[model samples]
Target: EDKVVQSPLSLVVHEGDTVTLNCSYEVTNFRSLLWYKQEKKAPTFLFMLTSSGIEKKSGRLSSILDKKELFSILNITATQTGDSAVYLCGAGGTSYGKLTFGQGTILTVHP
Candidate 1:
């Protein structure tokens, strides 16, 4: 059975504060690690990390994978209230694309 864990289950920050989310996994036949952001209903895909030490970034969001450590980190800079959401990381493999998701880190950005 594959399992994923996320640190600091919840966070509260003011606008413009930076945040870092951590995810670690232990699974069989690991293929990829994916990051997503959920605001209201659906979780929006953020990044898919397959290679170690490679950082994926888009605007204020960026993530990196450490395959050797079986962990990943997500960073959000210059955060705004809109950045408040549940951040998720999923461990994916050949099991018909099924992913084991983390508990999720709830971020609250207040102005």
Candidate 2:
């Protein structure tokens, strides 16, 4: 069975603040770590990290996986009010394309 856990279930921040979200997991056969952002609709894929140490990044979001520690971290810099949403972390197991997701972390960014 694969399980994922995310810390700081919720957060409140102001615009331009930087935040770091944590995720740890345990899986039968780990394949990859995935990050997603959800507002009202379906979760939008943010990043997929398979290799340790290498970071995947977008304009204001970045993530990295540490395979040995079975953990991953998502960093959001200069957050905007529009960035407020639920952040999700998922663990990919040997079952291709199937992911086990953790309880989402709700982020509230104020202007």
Candidate 3:
């Protein structure tokens, strides 16, 4: 069956720490993998991975995809309390942007 899995469901860290979050998936007809940050109500888009081996970075956050392994990783550096949020990864299949998401990785950054 096609499904998505995320590791380290939750983490707690002091400010300025670096963390790595993982997402793996298996889909019958894969298209892309997307990452999101959910701080309050709506989730904000982070990265969209369609090709493997290319890393996407924005500010202190970065992500990479491995199509062969069917997995992806999100890394955050110099974390801050404002960075505390739920990191979500969703896999898009051949079905028109339809995505199946992993549970989420909750990161707590304490000052």
Candidate with the greatest lDDT versus the true structure: 3
The clash count for each model shown is 0, 0, 0
Q: Write the per-residue lDDT of candidate 1 for residues 39-83, one digit (tens) a residue.
A: 999999999999999999999999999989999999999999999
Off by over 4 Å in 2: none
Candidate 2 shows a clash count of: 0
lDDT of 3: 0.95
lDDT of 3 by residue, 23-109 (tens): 999987899999999998899999999999999999999999999999999999999999999999999889878899999999999
Query: Clashing residue pairs, candidate 2?
Result: none
Clashes of 1: 0
> What are the TM-scores, per candidate, against the unseen true structure?
0.97, 0.97, 0.97
Q: What lDDT does candidate 2 reach at residue 109?
A: 99
lDDT of residue 101 for candidate 1: 97
Q: Which lDDT values do the candidates have, in the order given? A: 0.95, 0.93, 0.95
